[model samples]
Every structure is written in structure tokens, then in C-alpha cells.
Target: MITTPEHDERMAKMTFASVYPHYLTKVEKKGRSKEELHQVIEWLTGFDDKKLQDLINEKATFETFFQQARLHPNANLITGVICGYRIEDIETPLTRQVRYLDKLVDELAKGRKMEKIIRGQ
Candidate 1:
């Protein structure tokens, strides 16, 4: 549904902003007020001020979280799950046979029939 390049760019910016608050602070620290800092933190974390403070107090690091995000299987599972198909349900013997037949047909159409090519017949 994300149709426009501009929308994708905005999403990328939001993702970067959410992932790196220090980067934003460095860019606008001088003119930014205390309320703006709170707003930025809230926007980044999708949490209220108290929750954000707790997260900070717990010694969370963006680098650590980002590394864990890369390893998370939720996204992988979601792709398969939402697609109305299971990966394991694929790759059956019947599917393999059909693929083999398709390859043979393609070879014959291209005048590279497998038996002649393979046996030098």
C-alpha cells in the first residue's frame, strides 16, 4: 500500500529518528526546548515519558536493541503467516516432480532436450 517514493522516504526518516535520538539531539539541541526533547523521546519509543525514563534507567542501548531486532524471527514468521501459506507445506515430492517436468519442457522448447544433451545422442 505504500505507493509513493515520498512516503517511503518519510517512513525511512521516521524509522531513523525512532532508532537514533542522539542523532536528532545533535542536529537540533541548541534551539530545542525541554518539551521538544520529551516529544522526541516519546515519538522515538512510542511510549509515554515515564516508560521512556524507565527504559533509560534500565540501561537500554539502541545498538544492542538493533542487533537483537536483526536476529528476531517475528518478521520472518509474519511474512509467511500473513501470506496465507506455510513454507513447510511447500517443497513436496509432487512439486519437485512438476518442476522437473517444467524444466524438461523448457529444454525441449529451446532445442536442448536433456537426453540428447546429457547422453550425447
Candidate 2:
């Protein structure tokens, strides 16, 4: 994934809060609960419910969000394509990290089990 400067900059500036509702809707429509969504988030980013809500309330950008995250050691276990880009092939660290979250959310929206979505972590 060769991200253009504009793309990366835009993504870096985009708030996690902006995307949060969409993710919530995606999973909720698939019959998943908010707690389950938060569970995956906690597994990947080490943000507990309180911290996650704080970030959302502060309107943190993607860059800020990841910077604050204590990313899971098992994060690399999250693989496959998301938004047409293969996770392993992405060279941009931030983009890959974002896609890792995307892939997890995608799996959740697709009705994948919690254990499987978080790679059994």
C-alpha cells in the first residue's frame, strides 16, 4: 500500500471519533454488541472502556489514537486484506495499523467469533 502524502495526511488528521460511529453501526447491524466492539478494541489497542471513551470525547485523530495505544503483541497476527490492501504488504506504519483495526472490525461485522477475530488472544 503506497499511500500518497495527501492520503496519509488526511487519515492522520481524521478523528477516531469520526469513524467510531460507523464501526459501531457496522457491528450493531450485524447483531454484535457495543461491548464486543470495545473488546476487540481493547485487545488490539489496550484502550479500556474508560480510556476509549475519553479519546472519543477528546476527538483524537488517528495519529494521536495510535500514539496513545499500547498495541497488543498479537497485533501482527491480524492479517488479510482490508480496503483492497493486504495487511502485510502495507509499508506505511500508520496505514497498516489503521487497516489492522479495519480488518478486525470487518471480521466482526461479518459475524466472526470474538476469539477468532482477535486471533485467540
Candidate 3:
């Protein structure tokens, strides 16, 4: 088990851009389109393609990435277990946000329809 400060420190140093390609690869390998991935991200963060690209180019850390993000009102609708931690049970704000993205991607890779993943069915 990790402590909050430890998790926060790690997230603060982790760059979203460095791992974003892996997310793209994961979904693409599952036959999901990159457009779909972008759509979900936009829905969650309120950052359209251009803004997202700008953030990626800036090499934003997970904290910085979410700090600038206007999280969707329905984001609370996204709930489930990811990597052994229940999304709602996550104690750290930044870590919860990261896991939210992870859970969404996991849903996509599982072949769930976009509507359900985005709207939380």
C-alpha cells in the first residue's frame, strides 16, 4: 500500500504525454479508434483536440493535466475498480482522476460501446 504523499509525489512527476501513446496503442490494439479515445477524453476533461494536443506538447504532469482540466459534471458517474482499487474508494484526488482515465480505457479495451463508457450505463 502506498501513502498519499508518496502517491502525490509520483503523480506530480509523471508526464501524461509519456504514457498517452501507450493508451492509444492499447485501444488501437483492441481495434478501438483513436477518435473514440479522443472523444472520451474530451468528454471527461473538457479539452478538445487542440487543447489536448497543446497540453501533450507541453508535457504536462498528471497534476498539471488535471489542474487545467474542467472535469465533466457527470464524472462522478464513472465508478468501478481499477488495478485493485475501487474508483470511489481512492483517497487521493490526483490518483482518483488518473484511475478514472484508466478505468475508462479499460472499458474501451473490453469492447464496451462508446455511449455506455462515456455516459456511464
Candidate 4:
């Protein structure tokens, strides 16, 4: 499916905080812990507990959230189909980053080991 620029725009404008709870519920319902979820996010975005909370409290948009992120060096290693799009094939940087995060969380929820999710530390 071609992602129209408007679609990307809406996705970019999505609030990270608004979507966080859903992600948390998905993982937790699958027997994962919040720490594990946070670990996955931190690995992708480099935001520790406080920073993450601050962003959440501020209801940061995906654009603002990523703008503040110092992405992991191995973030490119995160590649797969997620949300119906191939992660590596995504042309928009923000969209790719979002899918990288989604793919990581999906892996965690599926019980993949943390070492593998973070690309072996």
C-alpha cells in the first residue's frame, strides 16, 4: 500500500503518549513487563525513564518525539514488515523510525529475547 503524504502527515502528528498505553497493554497482555517495553523503546530512541516520562507527560507528537531521540547506532538493524509496511523499504524517515519501534515492541510482545531485540547490546 502506498503511504500518501497525508497519511504520513497524520502519523507524524500522532501523539506518542496517546499511543503508549495501547502498546503497553499489548505487551503486558502477552506476559511482558513494562520494564521490558521501556527497555525496547530506550534501545531504539535512547530515552531513559525520566526523559520518556517527560515526553509522555508532554504528549509529544511522533515528530517531536523522534526529533529529541538520539537513535541507537544499530537502529538500522531493525527491519521487518510491521503495520503492513516493510520497515527497510519505507522511504520516509519518520515512518521508518516509527515502524522500527513498532517492530521492536512486537518482537518483545512475541517473547523474543531482549539481546536479540536490541541487536545484541
How high is each candidate's TM-score?
A: 0.29, 0.97, 0.92, 0.96
Displacement of the residue 66 alpha carbon in candidate 4, Å: 0.2
RMSD of 4: 1.1
- Residues 1-121, candidate 2, lDDT per residue (tens digit)? 6878888888889999999999999999999999999999999999999999999999999999999999999899888988888998888889888989999999999999888988868
**Which tens-of-lDDT digit does each residue in 11-115 have in candidate 3?**
767999998998899999999989989988888899999998998999999899999999888888889888887888777878888888988888898899998
Better of 1 and 2 by TM-score: 2
Model 4: how far residue 89 lies from native, Å: 0.3
Each prediction's RMSD to truth: 24.0, 0.8, 1.8, 1.1
C-alpha lDDT (0 to 100) for residue 26 of candidate 2: 97
Q: Write the per-residue lDDT of candidate 4 for residues 2-99, one digit (tens) a residue.
A: 67899799989999999899899999999999999999999889999999999999999999999999999999999879988988898889988888
C-alpha lDDT score of every prediction, in listed order: 0.34, 0.92, 0.87, 0.93
By TM-score, is 3 or 4 better? 4
Task: For residues 41-69, write the lDDT of model 1, one tens digit per residue.
Answer: 33322446665555456554443323222
Overlapping backbone residue pairs in candidate 3 total 0
CA error at residue 61 for candidate 4, angstroms:
0.1
Q: List the residue pairs that clash in candidate 4.
A: none
